[model samples]
Target: MHPLPQLESYAIRTFEIDCNQQLTIPALVRLMQETAMQQVLELNISVWDLEQYSLAWVLIRKRIEIERLPMLGEKISIHSYPTGADRVFTYRDFRVYDEAGQQIATAATTWLLMNLQTRQMSRIPAELLARFSGYFPPVEMALPYALDSLPPMEQAFTSRNYVVGWYDLDFLKHLNNVHFVKWMLEALPEETLAKQQIRRMDLLFLAEGNLHDRIDAQFQQIDEATYLHQLVRQEDKKVLATGRTIWV
Candidate 1:
């Protein structure tokens, strides 16, 4: 079997940080993309050489758990690899650590290849899967997480609404997870925003709503305890996604 690929490294870009002085979720997602690309390169089948192929990797669903987000000035080391493949999804794993090697977060995201022109998922090419299977690494204590549905929608919280926009889509052409967090965070009262420091958070994506899709964002909490937020499609009342944040 091939050895696990070397960990990928990147410096935090200023534009990737939010006003909170920490790496935003969207930026973290980019880092995941960067490392995964490196993993693809190790197999000698990266997209850079895909002029002959009409298919592309697409992000389907992701479940991330962050212990503490990296500060603006800190650098992070991300170790990632394709863990395994299911019927239609190839699972990729990630381990993020600070400069001191203290693990900050662990996550797993699933991806599927899509025909660029057809825009539909394609089967996992056997050769491609075989090459990646050998590079699987040892599972860490908190390996890539398997996301579960939000415990309950509990309407006990305050809620606000916002519409989706074109800019929110990623390479997969749907609402990126970070954009969901942004809209939900915005629902917090200005006073709660004054001294907020998120210790950890989780995002659970459900149905994919389109541009101009009005979403109802709800939240309720006070005095530094964990806060819960949920995003739902306003018209159908369908839950779009859910998020949780622990702050001080």
Candidate 2:
């Protein structure tokens, strides 16, 4: 269920810059999400209307590979398209560009339809999924383990957590991937954070998590800043997604 009409573009704002003077990774992602909202609104599927049915679309998982960060005062254009929609799942794709038209990042994301009251997975309404047709390239929802999986975590990587609250949820309802990464990055040390830059990142998903789930992000130092990151259940230590971000 891809929507085909136009590519959504965004303007940069002052507050969005990170300490390194580039747009914060989270803000870049927020812009990509903003573009999708514009597409949906152009299709006449207002956020207010979706709320009427006690339904919301939640980004289940996303992967972003950035080439270079954009600095302050630069304008951006983001093209967003639906990959396709499947029962209980919808795929979204994005390409971000800088003022000079060079590509900055490419991200593909998956979303799931959820019932507000029960907070359970539900099938995408046929009409809702069809709204995206003609707009997205042929895309498919990824199944677990097929993307890739990692081995079990070490014992040191257990019983940590960051709570789910109003601010943690993005426009998409699920926890933002950057927030997950931020927690993973910050949990280490400033020395590690300052010296190492992420060279490669691979993340795999196993389940959806939300409010009050008692989640903890775990890590093992490969060397310097490189690490194996795991998001786990606090009680059982069930693996949610295993990730690796290597530092250069």
In the range 60-149, model 2's lDDT, one tens digit per residue, is 666667787677877778887676666777777777888889978877677777788897988877677656655655434322212345
Highest TM-score against the true fold, candidate: 2
Global lDDT of each model? 0.72, 0.67
lDDT of 1 by residue, 70-138 (tens): 987798999887777766777777889999999898776767776667767788777767767776655
Pairs of residues clashing in candidate 1: none
Candidate topping lDDT: 1
Error of 2 at 20 (Å): 2.5
Score candidate 2 by TM-score against the native: 0.75
Per candidate, the number of residue pairs that clash is 0, 7
